[model samples]
Target: MAEQGAPQRRPSIHDVASHAGVSAATVSKVMQGVATVKPANVQRVFDAVERLGYRMDPLASELRRSKRRIIGAVVPEFESEFFGTVITELERLAEQRGYALVAASSRESEAREKEILARMHDWRVSGVVLAPVRNERSPAAAFMKASGMTGVMIDRVLADNAFDTISADSAAASAEVARALVGNGHRHVLVIGLGEQAATVHARLEGFRAQALALAPDMRIDVILSESDVAPLRASLRDYFGKGERPTAVYSLFLKGTLVALSEFRRRGWHCPNDISLVGFDDAEWMQVTFPAIAAVVQPVRRIATQAMDLLFRRIGGEEGPSRALLEPCKVLMRESVGSPGGGARAGGGDGQ
Candidate 1:
């Protein structure tokens, strides 16, 4: 032991290698979890690290590796459960790989999304995971390509093919929802979506429409693109009901829309599956606790997070090939919310004021 006033010498990778009877490079590879490293060497390195209390300096390691040990993640909304779960899982995966994450929410603004990308460039992050906004002309792929930055797109995809993307099979899943609704004997239906700004939403609409029309060409499926805010959604719903005949069932493209629809129905004193049927694209905790459990298509958040990180790291690690689009299947849970269509709005129902 050293004197009280003396500084302690921190054990270095060289010391660990010497104790483990391996080269410094081998120790480094083991610490990095390189599959090429021998199993016995990895065990020895860990044992030596434990015995010597050795800790690698992140800054020095980053400099030596010629890349920052930080990843940037940008999403449309951080408040939503889907994106919140994604960021949490990404942070966990990054920590496991000895990297840090810088997360940002664009709040569904194209300008804000662009600004976040620029900041990621300034920070010289090792890579990015972007869930782009609804703009058709987003320059994310071009910017990343120009800056020699690597990334993976998650949730929503752009038209560009420069980056790998991971998302649920929105079209097929939405089509499945349509099949369920049509099979339940609902001919007239309403589809409430945020807008066509997101490729995910667009895909969902196209899939639902295509499948529904294919099944029953005479079916009346009315669609309305509502603003995501509660008041605007309520207004849109009110206007829809006031304009024409009421739908037997409603399919909301997102969670907020689902909640707003439920609230609107409750305000009118309409019973779910009795007066109107409902389905949503996203699964949420509150959806289950309500009077009637909501039917939803559950996106595999963990799988998406894992796949995005895997793809992003692969790009960062110099993997070269065509950019890939990975789509995971969604699980549809048909709960009590979906049922046979009622005739129309009931007599005692509120005026939806």
Candidate 2:
């Protein structure tokens, strides 16, 4: 007695059972491929399901099967080679351990990250791995803690101290690089792209300034915050390079700022290490192939990814332990970007002439 042109709702298991002349319980058993259902009835239920377009919910089915098999990975940016490598390694490890990884990018926005976490929660993911934003805490972090969801943090740590963290030794690494530059006879050095209060950046700045000042008491150390943009950095570098009091060497804290500094130098036809020595954090694939390869502090991406997955799995298994803090060393790659005080070869280039 339904209206002829009325829209129809998709069928459910009850509709399948009614059409197949079986109980709802029988339909469910057959749909689940239980051995107790008669072969003929199973076939009939399957036919009814196909006809009605009835589909089983994956999360519900997974729960019924009692499998803790899904984990979520949230990162700030997917376009960066660094995060891409982390995701790739995590996925491979997850698959090896009979688990699946559902990865999402926060795009460096708190609201977007919160929504992604909600979606992952709806999917009944067993655990989560996150690289929180540099300055702000993610809403998802508190939610995950409240919901009893297991999680591990990579790269930046959340301010709440609710989740385990695995990060590179930013402070120590930056200090070593500063020492290297100072050891090479560079007196005045500049560090770029870190905010004054950013934990990672602050640590690096502390180390760099401490070491530079320790080596030469009269050292002039300058720190420039990038404000997350390249134009200001380019302008600053250009102005500094044009000035007669430019730092003997420049150390860029982030990849984007590093690239901007390199491009600005190249555009102005200034040679690296010769005119002004440069060093940057994070190594990229093309770094070694550039005109003059850039020196970098490289973090072990694969190892960090693997350890994060392991911690996430253990937490999902209801293992109770203190929050973990891991610090991996950064390997410094020596290239043509660093040299002595008078420049490696172009010392007498006459101050941006």
Candidate 3:
């Protein structure tokens, strides 16, 4: 029913504003879901936008305005529960402060991370929240600095000095868990899935090793590098168990590593807190709902998200100061998975009843 060769006209906020007899700012406010405008005015704006088929130009007109109101979030994985929660909190805070959020995930690859950062730059985002992968830093950091883009590094430290950073006290958190295990009378403990030379991983390993040495000066620690190498981890576990000198407890650095170790332990019919104690970093959703609740050091996901956004906004507002590094303390959640070292300790199960 439409003419095939008709010239198509691109819609603009100005067109909608003209039709609604309002200012461009009013139309922008309406599009952003600002509640300050009266309902009748909002209806008028919506009607004009619908009639004109006005698609939002997030990069050019709306976001790049002189006020600096668009915030970009770059994370490793959007699907992870921790990052998902962070995104939610950041968006909520940004909305309350009359700013918009544009988010992207790097999928744990350095090249992808650079591509996404470039895209966000084209979007003219005033600020960015990044969780970069380790061992790679180049023109991206330079671009962020030279382009005047205020940035905050979340969950990981950046190798370059271009952005403010906010992360948990990894070393202290790991030390606390190790100390807890030692206090429970466990001497021999194994640390699993610490990657090669990552900033966060290294901090955790250092903390764990420090506590282990303080308690038992000559205690032997088995360090497993590749968490994804399930066969090697299983082989190590089997060998340790078979030698009649099994570690009394295991500390996993990541959720995936924790899951793998737990699955292997379960397959062997070994009970937690009785056969061996367990502690993990980063609590997952199912951990709370499972039969045996796992003990963990809970990172302040919401706080980190909110603070990162706030810092970014301040920087965008021309607040000149030295780049800051915020280290949030983690809380240890004691659950049934950890118990006294000696045998005959009752294995505590979750509230599955």
Candidate 4:
């Protein structure tokens, strides 16, 4: 019998083994799920564990295994609605798989993105999901090659096919937007984009331009590809609106781009459809709640997140095959913001202040 006023010692594997009347090795084999252990011994070990309240140390067990159940993810930025949703979905999926997920944001810096990849490699993560800042020869690909890191590229895709990639069908979706604008008699169109160097944005620009001109040979399409900074975006939008031949319809290729254009147009007292029709790439919540309810495209972020983690786990599990570049289609939600060009309103021109 234990003495009163004495400290209680935590139950250990040895205690469980003693309670089960088996060797410590047998207890460990049973706990680790080794199939060679006898059925009777397995039952005894479970019963002893329940009685002694002996729980295996997860960290110690991970150390004993060759691969740690840890996944790392790096994105260009966390503030964006798209990336934020992806991260949240990935965390939930990883937890369901009995793995811990670590997330990092690069703030849209190529150097910072590479640094995060290096740190993830150093940590010996089981796998990584990387949304690189640069689409052209991403430094992440080179770093992964040198470090022998296993990962899947998300959002921005590389041309070299160096790794498995998952992204929305940006070109198709952007082309659909152009088709809608041209169908509505919008010959004069404006496209607001960000980071022309990015693969996703570049694809959108080309897709819109190609489709608009193909549908209407004489369409006048003006494109403004600005930096991510709001100052540059606002300056370009103001300059365009202040000049001659105001666009009848505008297609914004990014969420922030859409917001900035809407704000600038409102500040200039220009109303939607009556003055200008608008469409955007991301279907943000406010887009739905606005007075006119802006038309926009909805990216399949949940599917992208799940597929990326699935491919990453396959690689971690030693599956060998040619890397796949999968493109998921986006859904376009057209609201009241898109309409035919106004007859007399189109001719009404001012300083657009």
Candidate 5:
């Protein structure tokens, strides 16, 4: 046959039941360890499952268990400094408040994030803290509609106002960065960004553009947006920078964008702050050690995380009212990499050097 040697797809629960000469419902009961099932039938179900390499999804099993004092947290990823820091603080604070934290990585996949949310629901966690994947109506909304688990959002702001949210004011920070650069004599700027579906990224971009245009009526603020593909990101950056007309400074809206843009600059033998001024929305550890340590508008991760947990606790304690959001202030950490749009740092704006 043309398909010879191709592996057969793994068996499903139905297939396992058919192979064991039992009904799907019976197999499900056996898998759930129902003592009422005949012992022989239980053995047959297990044998069939093992032979077919069939395994139960943890959610299915979790559905049968009693609830726990667990709080679930879902983040896009930790490559960015803010998310990793927020999760660490959330877990630490959760422990102090006598709760357990279960963390999941969405890897920036909306579908995967939804599956994780469903799993959390099935496991009957007392509450959840979410840094939702960006979408018009992300799984966060679906989760709210389909489950009773109380969720408090952090980092990314969801469009829906049906849930409590805690986050540093990303828009304010972006505006501040724009002001700093304009004050340092920069006329034109470029924003390199991804997280196209994310609400927080959108807010930051809006703020930056609004402030840049307002500050200098003649300034040009160029934007480059893409999905989370690294190859396309590199190619796009190369294409933009390869052009004759370049923005005076570059602002990276996402951490991935920041790291990728830095690599591209290095590949082109361009030095930051010397060739182009730079800043990011989030500060990373390596930024502190970079040749011309990069400037960033930094979030207060610990405070945001703690506040999110507080909101979750309030919801869990049956506090009922219209959902609200708490926006904290963010500050620009001016460093060597952000100075004059043309060459070097400002007279006294430099950090360290």
Candidate 6:
């Protein structure tokens, strides 16, 4: 147990050189049988290396002899649990496979995303996993194609049928959540979130609307396109709810959008599952801890990332052919958020508020 707490890595050539008070090149010369290395300096280097139990990083040396082994990944957001977990897991896998990861958050900007791709290309990264800014033929894709780096797209794909792609089965997940809401007696539903931007968002909205309308043909579904800045969201929420009958249920399409909805509900002094029901598309840890413990569609973040990494590795290994796509399903976490249209929290359950 005590040993477990100690540093796991063996001492490196640099460490040995530092201990011997010599240059790394001097130590390298000693290791490579350079006769010009003074016997005394060589002896000191050997002594330091033995004392520290140092070993050469063979993979690092070999990769230098071959090519850059760094994999670049760019995501739209980082503070969210989903992207954070997926990127961290990919980094772990990359390190295990003797490759390095250089990750960046594009913050959902096309310009920033393109810049990241350009920088990664200049650095000659072995591959890249990109969560693009839009679902279209982008300058970023053109950059990747011209650079010839094995690229695997993640989260929202920018182009379909042209490259390896991996993402959550958002359409299925949306349909599932829509069914849950409709079945729970939510007749008038308000769909608000940042889902009007990309292909992933469009698919989710289409799936939810289709399934929900099929379930209850008479059900009403309204939408308010949300901006990242909460001020616009607040204005939209106030404008929509002020003029019309309050929605029986509010469905937030993204994690950040869910937060905006929660804040608006609080500002209005509204109680969930009492006067209005709430359901969000993306799950968050705090979502389960908050008042009414909001129900959400839980994305298979780890599975999607694993599949993406697998595809990226295949692409890096020179797998040639048509693009591949893996669509994994998301699950629903039914908490105390949704209930009947006019009724409060269900019997036997404490209102989270």
TM-score of each: 0.84, 0.75, 0.75, 0.81, 0.78, 0.80
- Tell me the TM-score of model 1: 0.84
lDDT of 1 by residue, 164-235 (tens): 888989999899988887877889989988956678889999999999999989889988886545577789
True-structure lDDT of candidate 4: 0.82
Off by over 4 Å in 6: 1-66, 346-353
lDDT of 5: 0.77
Q: Which lDDT values do the candidates have, in the order given?
A: 0.81, 0.74, 0.74, 0.82, 0.77, 0.77
Q: Rank the candidates by TM-score, best first.
A: 1, 4, 6, 5, 2, 3
Count of backbone clashes, every candidate in sequence: 1, 0, 0, 0, 0, 0
Query: What digit string (tens of lDDT, one per residue) describes model 5 on residues 102-203?
Result: 999999888888899898888788788888778326866577656766788777774445688877788888888888888888898888888676788788
- Provide the lowest-lDDT 10-residue window in model 6: 344-353
Give the poorly placed runs of model 3, Cα more than 4 Å off: 1-68, 135-139, 158-160, 227-245, 344-353
- Of 1 and 6, the candidate ranking higher by TM-score: 1
Tens digits of per-residue lDDT for model 3 on 1-353? 65899888788889989999999998877665455677688779878876786767545655456534678887778766788999899887666545688888877666788888888888767678887665224345556767777688888663345677888888888988877777667777888864555577888888999987898786677776663245676677667667776777888887766887788789888778788778888898777766567777788899888778767766665566677878898887666777776553334532211
User: Which residue ranges in model 4 land beyond 4 Å of their true spot?
Assistant: 1-57, 158-160, 343-353
**CA lDDT, candidate 4, residue 245:** 50
Best by TM-score: 1
The pairs that clash in candidate 2 are none
lDDT of 2 at 290: 81
lDDT (Cα, tens digit) per residue for candidate 6, span 208-314:
99999999999899988754455687688888777865888888878877888778777888888887888887888898888788888888888888787767766
Better of 3 and 5 by lDDT: 5
Tens digit of lDDT per residue, candidate 2, span 118-142? 8888777878888876632557777
- For model 2, the superposed segments whose C-alpha errors exceed 4 Å read 1-61, 65-68, 135-137, 158-161, 194-197, 239-245, 345-353
Write candidate 4's Cα lDDT for 1-353 as tens digits. Answer: 88998888888889988999999999876654355667698779878887776766659868787656678999988988999999999987665444678999989888888899899887888788888886737887789877888888888774445578889999988888888778779999989888878889988888889988999999999888886576798898898778865999889989999999899889999888788988899888998898788888889999999899777766775667798989998987667777788732322221111
